[model samples]
Target chain A: MMGISEYFESARIAYQAIIANKTRAFLTSLGIVIGIFFVIMMGWFLDGLDNAFDKTINAIGTDMLYVDKWSWGGSDDWRSVQKRKPISYQQALEASKKMTTAELVAPHASKWGGKITYQGNTLGSVSIVGVTAPFVNTPIGNLKEGRFFSETEDVHSVEVVILGYKVANAFFPDRSPLGEIMRINGRKFLVIGVVNKRGTIITDFIDNQVFIPIQTFMGMFGTARRGVQIAVKAGSQELLDEVREETRVIARQVRNLQPGEEDDFTINESQMFRDEISTLRLYVWGIGIGLTGLSFFVGIIGIMNIMFVSVTERTKEIGIRKALGAKNRSIMWQFLVESSTLCLFGAFIGFLLCATVIFAITSAFPDVDFLTPYVPLHLLFIASIVSIIVGIFAGLIPAYRASRLDPVEALRYE
Target chain B: MNNDIIINIEDVAKTYQMGAETVHALRSVSLQIRKNEYIAIMGPSGSGKSTMMNIVGCLDTPTKGTYLFENENVATMNDNELADIRNRKIGFVFQTFNLLARASTLKNVELPLVYAGVKKDERQQRAFAALESVGLQDRTHHKPNELSGGQRQRVAIARALVTKPSIILADEPTGNLDSKTGVEIMRLFGELWKNGNTVILVTHEEDIARHAHRIVRIRDGMIESDTINPSPAEV
Candidate 1:
């Protein structure tokens, strides 16, 4: 424990030592500064990208489990497990009735090329989906205007349609699309609703899409006999695993699979999309943290080299102090303080550079909503600890050398 | 008659164990100095006068003898005790002026107080006062390089005196100075003696030696002679 004035005096000596040789001090701090700068900047950039990814995934739906023929997330396997025939629309209807954990089960049917037209104004062709009333509630798709078609309308095989918000905006910019007549794939359909501006979770929220009742869709453009997937919805996260298990068992029963055999279909959470984003996040962190660590290592090495020079240059000074009753530990502490101060200064500069870069990038890209300018306190904490650790580690050799210098030889040194 | 003994050496010796050889730097030297004794320790090169000074200043332990400083056996003292004695009882002025190169004059003079863990205000006041005593108060902020040889030596002297230690052990204090500067520095030491602090000067200069009340001469790791001056300088 040092008294305040003495502590400040020691710090002043360290400061003066660096000031006397500014160029050397800056050069020594260069590696560390660059290392941390790039690392922190990369971290912020990746965080922004991950935010974009999560928003894209969330646009599709929450709670809706995508039970398809393939695994839900990104995969490494080159070949898809030989395309198990797609789950049938009947099987989706059957599971909807059977699973106690399910809130709603939307039997979906779809095709990619559907040209939509409202009078003389024609919107571009898009992937049209045929779905149940439950889909609007389960995935919680937004309704920008009017309402989604009624379940009774699907039961009656009504020729009704719901336009995605983008389609409504593009083809009918000023007019209310509800109660208007539209044409889908040359078939007449009445516009019942316009879906709300989509969440930034999946795809470009402005991409054109149209939804019609599954019953009318099949009647109008014959069913493929095999549906792509039966989307299931769980009540809550607490029921997620349980609902998934029950859905799997029910799907097996509907598909007529016996016990002890693998089922034909896959059941997984909508969250799998976010998990893919997470694994990618891990890689981002890995690269960022590893690079930062490398810079820290390089910075510490530079500090160590300088400490050696400092100890040797001041060998006689250390000797004189020892002659005047300074202990080995005191000499060690002096050099440690010097080394630590250098590292702390470098860390402060590096963090500032990182923070500035983050701010600049966000300002440059205003639409990038994920950019957060405020650096987390944890990063500052980490930088401080790094500085202190570097001080102790880098100062060790010089401190030892200084402490071991014999008073007699030191005094004799010219 | 018995007087207060500040430094007592009894058959002290120092041997350096170099590779494949032993160099005898000190051999059975015995002497005593009471309080406030102004003495000059003089000898040729390799004569162990520096070695004797080191032992007297408690900077080194003797190889085969006892050194008692004010009745505390220095031979049995720990490093902390030696440091305590150095800071509290014996001040040192070196030949090279040994001021920390990057520090200011005030800081150089405050080094001992720093070791003594003195408060910053008191250290500054004391160091300033010591510099004033050496007639260097105006140059208190100047670094060694900015000062002349005489000024740097004054700063060194201020540092030596700032601790208010009993003995000012000056090893060739004026070795780097001109003859005129040397006499001036000797005059400063004479004034310090007049103020009642013990001053030990280690030099080969007979003129510098004449400034002290007693002279101890060494030759080849042993005392050649010890004598008192017939007529000491009147202050």
Candidate 2:
């Protein structure tokens, strides 16, 4: 093995050679720059997606299960699910009362495509969700301002509402919406609270929904025909499966299904959202890796071709060094250093470009939840390591060829 | 091999396979040299003088017979071993000067030491001393392209001498210079020889070969004459 000083000398020689041919070095490393840029951007995007997905799934409450007419995650046939009878508000209430392992149960009945108006401003295609006072204990039900409606207000059907974060922001940009009276379907309701910003790309509609008491909703729009979904939160994460099983039994009892009959309603959990996100992430990664691999392959070819040219151009120098007592390993190290330095330069440039783009995007849309403001530090580390590996792989053949040159013939080369 | 003999060659031959035919570059040659002897090997083109130089410098091994440098068999040495021997024991001066065009005169001279894993401070000091010996001390930072042909050859000489090798091997060292510049280089070789450094000159020019104390002539891959010059030509 050569000493560290010898390696440094080889690296010094390599640096001089690259500087002597600046244009060729830059052009040769262009492929590496673009490849690394694509790789870093893809990594940043996927990490943002994962982080946002985790936050949104947590907002949906991982320990909670939903008993609804429709199955989530596309697990059941749509036609069959639609043909099943809907869970009534009374049945939901009964099931909630019977669920022993649940921490709290919030029965929800939603009316979509409803309009909410404040002064001259109006938001179209908003969802109006009706739930009891216990909904405040759920994850998405956490308030950003003011307080949730009391059980007294819900029982008395006092027409109090909680606005979603975006709805509040749109309606009262200059002032708080806590005491403002808003009209939902032309009926007046005082805003008592504002839900926190808890929406991701998968569940962005949560931001456009307004919450009201269940009794008020049933009074305005008759209760017999509308279906209700029950949100059941487990006492602890460890009791989720037990709560789910108990909820299923309560639901079956509420619906009065025969022993042999399969329960009509579906019990959906946040795990369904996680599973879907993972599958989507797999596809994204598949395409991202495929594209990144292709670019790197092209980059490797570019560097290898240029290294071969460099070796040929410096044949006489190789001979001279060999004659000066340089071993084959020394020559190999010289070219390897040159190639890796080129790749490292390219990676720096690529990382800068990626950072600039990410900075521009995140600054432009500061409210965006799924785009991070800066690239992660670990991704930079990964890119540098990957670039060096690529450089070594690309420079291997050319370096070996340079090391094996016949000193006499190489010196004879013009 | 005698203790005083720095190089010993016995029935050494080299051949090249040219397609289906084998070309005999050297046919059964033998020679010996003491540690401080100054000699020149002279021949026409393809007369095996170049082959002898290659074998003596450890750049190429004999295909037959044996060659011993400092009592070590050169014929059976591996490439790395040959490289090590060349690094420590043989200094080569080429017809073209062969200085790295991009490197300064100092760096070009420091190349051998760099490969030998010498520390930077000592390498620079030694390389500077070598440049001073060749009267290129002031041009240490000048590149080969920036220097004259004679100056470039001096830099190459400085590089050759940096390692303080067992022998200085010059193959047509003045082949690329003008007559005056060529004479100046031969004078430098004479001074080195007078200072007790072993010098071997490989040249087709009689004027250059006459500078040495002894001359050996070859023809058709075999030595024709080996004679001492009673009084060497004045530099």
Candidate 3:
């Protein structure tokens, strides 16, 4: 067993040798630099992706339940789901009245691929939603400007509409959108409010939409008995499961389904969407780790080759050290220290490059919340450990060879 | 000094297998060295002088022999034990000065003490003292590349003496130096011998061998003569 001082002495010698041959050491460490760069970049990107997913999930509300005719996640039996009767708006209102655990309920319907226009400017392929006043109280429907349509407007079928932030910006870039007249499907409506920006909540393009009172929407688009979705907010976060159960019961009662018969409607939560996202994240992590592993393997080979050359070049020095009474372990430790130092130097450079690239990308797309990569502390810790492990593995064979050299033969080597 | 035999060799032989051919480097050599004895082994090239030096310095094991260092059989010791023996007992100076080119003169002198697990302050003190003894104390921080040839050889000598080993084995210590520098190194060896340290010089030069009190001549892997120098040359 070597003492602490001996190991430090060996490290000092290794450091001097590396400094003496700076260009060769840098070239040998290039592979490690590229490998660590990819690893760090991948880790930062995954962290950013997780943050974005969490934001989207928060916007969609973990404590709310969505009751709809079709499930949010894809089902195997499409024909059976299609055979069920549509969830009418009347049924939504009936279920809300009978629900015991819900704090509020709103009925919603939407149409897509329609154009909206103000004066000569037109926004194409915009989504148009119709909902009751209580819809604004849900997680993603907060108003950024103006007021929501009143209950009287919804009851009387008045043509008052609320625009999303993106829609409002397109129509009125310099002025407030309140009381502006916009044409939807060639029908004129008064804008009452604008929904706050909720950047890409799940798969929904919530910002590229406009909302109108349900009664006015039915009158303008002609309701053909199509299903409407019912969104219910639990009384509190603790009562979410209880509220979902009560909602299922109340919805079954409103739909007049028999006790033994399965309900045709499905209830969904943010967790379901999050689970699907997790599956995609797993695949990304696997591919990222595999590619990085391959690069690290190549880096280890490069370091090993360079260490062999170094041992050959320092044969006479090794002999001198041995003749001076250095043990085999001492010689081995010196080379190992040299290789690890090279790897750590490369890792530092990799971290700098990764940080710079992430900064450039985030700056270029300021509006994209998911594009801002973040380097977590755990990622840096793991990279340092991996670099050290690679160094030891790469330096093993060469250091052993050096330690086993015969002093007589080494001294004779030119 | 009392007649205490520090090295005892009996029928020590060494053989090497170069490819398929076996070459006998040392053939049944037996000799005894006492404390504080200054001896020179002289031979032509390929006369087994180097092989003898390697064996005596504990750098190599004899193929067949009973060699005792301080009455302990060194031929049976393992690599680590031999390394310990070499660390505490034997000092080696080579023809090329063999100092670490990148390390400072002090660090080169401190190398053996580092392997011995000595503390830093003590190691430095001893290394500085060794450099002072060789008249190179002012050159302690200078690297081997920055020093002249003679100064580099002084650093090597200081390194050899740092551990205060029982024996100093010098192999053509001045082979790379001019005649004047060579004599200066020989006088340094003479001073060390006067200080009661055993010095063994291996060389092919007659003038270098004349500095020793005893001279042993080897021819074709066998000792031809071992005799006391009637009047040794003074450096």
Candidate 4:
């Protein structure tokens, strides 16, 4: 086995050679620098993407199941789903009462493009959602101020509303919005609560919505036309399948479907959304890895070419070392060390550049929290290990060629 | 003086194949060298003096002969074995000095010891001592390009002596230096010889050959004469 001292000696010689030819060494390392820079930045972007998706998915309750006429992720035959009977609020109320496994069942309905007005100030294109009191117990519903509508208000069809954070800020920027009366489509509604900022998940603008009691919404929008979505929360993760089965059975009975009859509603969970996100994530990863692989291949070829040149340039020096008692392995190790040092230098510069770019992007778009790139410690570790492996693979042939040179011929080389 | 034979060469021949024709570089040469002897192999260019030097230094194996270093046949040894012999038993000083141009004088002197796996502190101490013997201890930190030709040669000599090999083989040790510096280098060799090290000098210059106690003249791939110099030149 070669001693540690011998490796150090080889590294020392490699350092001297690099210092002696500064411009050559720098030029040779440029390819690796650029390649590693792209790889690290892409990795950081992917990390941020994963974090954003996870935050968005977690905001939608993981244990909750959505019962609706259509699947959460749209299916291929949407016309057939549209032809199926729209789920009604009565069926949701029936399922809530008949279900045995669900911890909470909240019925909800929505009307987009609604305008909310407080005196002369108007917030247009607002989403209006009608939900029961139990909707506040779900993950997506958290109050920053006041309280959600009571079960008495929901049953009595009281004109009570809960404002989203952004809506409240727009109408009453300097004062608390609780107890203020806001006009929703010319109907006076008392603001009983304010939803906390739930930042946009994919395309859903949760913070730009207003929530009202389902009975009041039915009075305004006419309950006979609109469909209601029933969100069922499982008591525990292990009971999710059982809760889903119970909800499906109750829904079927409410729809008066007999045995072997096709169901009129779709059962949805957060997992379906996660599966959709994963498909998109796989595409991003494929593109990122493909581009990174190409760049690394080019970088490795550049390193190999430069190492070959270095070996040829130092043929006479190799002969002198051999004459002084250097074994072939020592000569090989010297060249290998030189190449690896070059790669490490490039990787260091690449890391600095990547960090600078990430900093710039984050600072430039402070409002775009999802766009903030994250450089994890594991990514850095993997980058360094990859650089070393690339160095070894690129330097192998050139080092072997240097080691096999006949001392007599090499000494004679000019 | 102890008459212990250090190198024994018998009917050694070296041939090179050049495009279907074999060129005889050395034609059946036989020689023996002992400890503490200062001998010069003198010849013109292409006269096989270098081939003989390479064979004696264990850098190359002869084609058809028996060459022994301390009673071990060297012609049959592999490349790694030859390298070991060169590292531990024989040291070489080249015509051009051949010092690593970017390394310090101390680092150049420490090369052989590094290959021998010597610890850093001991390698440095022994390299310093070798430089001191060559009168170059003060120039230990200078690079080859920073030094004069004679100083570079001294550094090379220090490197050769650092390993404390049985024989010091120098091929035209003063070939690139001025006469005064050449005399200085020759006197350093004389000092090393007096200190009980075998010295083999290969040169074509008669004045340089006169510095040795014995001289062998070669021409046309054959030895023309081998004789002892009665009055060796003094430094």
lDDT of each: 0.79, 0.89, 0.87, 0.87
Question: Residue by residue across A1-414, what tens digits does model 1's lDDT show?
Answer: 555555676688789888888888888877677776766676666766677666665565555677776676645232544456667777778877887877767777777767887777666657678888877775534677777877898899898888887788777789888898888888888898887765443455334778889888778767665465677767676777787888888888988898987767777565676677777778878888788778878888898999899888887888888777676667777888888888777777788888887778768977546676657557667777877777788888888788777777777776
Error of 2 at A124 (Å): 1.5
TM-score of 2: 0.96
- Superposition error at A308 for model 3 (Å): 1.4
Please give the distance, in angstroms, between residue A331's alpha carbon in candidate 3 and its true position after superposition: 1.5
The RMSD (Cα, Å) of candidate 2 is 1.7
Model 2 alpha-carbon drift over 4 Å, by segment: A363-367
Docking class of 4: medium
Off by over 4 Å in 4: A172-175, A200-204, B1-3
Off by over 4 Å in 1: A1-6, A45-64, A74-82, A110-127, A143-146, A153-210, A216-221, A225-228, A271-278, A360-374, B1-3, B77-81
lDDT of 4 by residue, A1-414 (tens): 676778998788778777887888777777778778877877787677677677776666678888988887775378888898888989889888998879999989988889998887888999899999999998767888899988999999999999987798888889998888999998999998998877544635777899999999988998787899998999667888899999899999999999998888998887776667778778877877787777778778888999899899999998988888888888889888888888877788788888888888988988776777455557677778888888888899999999998887888788
lDDT of candidate 4 over B1-235, digit per residue (tens):
2349998889999999999999999998998898889999999999999888888988789999999899889999988788888999888898899988888999999999998989999999999999998888899898899999998998999999999999999999999999999999999999989899999999999999998999999887788899999999999
Q: Which candidate has the top score in DockQ?
A: 2
Candidate 1 displacement at residue A402 in angstroms: 1.3
Q: List TM-scores for all candidates, in order.
A: 0.87, 0.96, 0.91, 0.95
Instruction: Please give, for residues A1-414, the per-residue lDDT of candidate 2 as tens digits.
Output: 896778888688778877888888878888888888888888888898888888877888889888999888787888888998888998988887787778999999999888998896789889899999989899989999989988889889999999998899888888899888999999999999999988887889888899999999888887787889999999678999889989988899999999999879999888888778888888878887888788788889999999899999999999988888998888998999888888888888889999999999999998777888978879889999999999999999999999999887787899
lDDT for model 3 comes to 0.87
Quote fnat for model 4. 0.68
TM-score of only chain B in every candidate structure: 0.95, 0.98, 0.98, 0.97
